[model samples]
Target: MTERVLVAYASKNGSTAGIATMIAEALREQGLAAEARAVGEVESVGPYDAVVLGGALYAGRWRREAVRFAWHHEADLTERPVWLFSSGPLDATAREGLIPPVPGVQRLVDRLKARGHVTFGGCLQDGAKGRIARMIVKSGRGGDFRDPEQIRLWARGVARELVKEVATP
Candidate 1:
């Protein structure tokens, strides 16, 4: 059977969700069965052969929902192939180089034994939720920094790894 992959995310302002969707689409193009879903909406990870979990960043920290999901499904995630991603950094740095996971997320990566991790640029645009977000937008600091091509490329790399793993076994 084709690998069943789950591209799950914890997004606060919809940017991370968009990245997760791109990932799932790329995996499908690579002939794997993949779907993107919110971490809170998923009850179990047992159905997936592999997982790509992502979170948005705030104040140099991974979103709380993402952290909670990782720990909550620690047992199941460790038993399968897992990749982690973070979508933040409102700049081009993510596409330019590898941005290491934050301390909290690094702990999750270590505990889960995730196969790999990547950090992507984030988006903060008008009408974003939260007072802080509004302030950023008002201060002219909020803008969409997400690059779809970069996200797709990363997802394709992830697909290659997953395909290789499944083919080996």
Candidate 2:
């Protein structure tokens, strides 16, 4: 059976959501059935054979909705193939300094045996920030650091993994 994959994300400013959409599209292109949805809108993981959960990182943490979604669907996620991703790190060097998922997320990943946790560069647009974020941007720590090629490459890897899983059993 073809695996149905859910690409669910929690995005603050739509950057992560864009990534999720791209991933879903790439998966579809790879012949898997995939759909992208906001974590807040996903009612259940029961309908999907696999999941790709992503969140926008802020202050070393993931959005609350994404974290809660993982916790709420822990059992199902543990049984299915799951992947996790975080999008944030406005600094060009942020990828080099990528931090592991926060403790809570790591615990869930451990329990679920998630396939992987990838961190991609993020974008910071003009006038899209709150005061603090604006300050951070003004401090020369911001730009559109997102790399389309990198994101596409990661999605292709995910597609390959899903294909392997379908062929395994």
User: CA lDDT of each candidate?
Assistant: 0.91, 0.85
The candidate that wins on TM-score is 1
Local accuracy of candidate 1 as per-residue lDDT tens digits, 31-63:
999999999999999999999999999999998
TM-score of each predicted structure versus truth = 0.97, 0.89
Candidate 1 local Cα displacement, residue 100, angstroms: 0.8
Which residue pairs collide in model 1, if any?
none
After superposing candidate 1 on the true structure, give the runs of residues whose Cα lies further than 4 Å from its correct spot.
none
Q: CA shift at 29, candidate 2, in angstroms?
A: 1.3
Q: State, as a TM-score between 0 and 1, how close model 2 is to the true structure.
A: 0.89
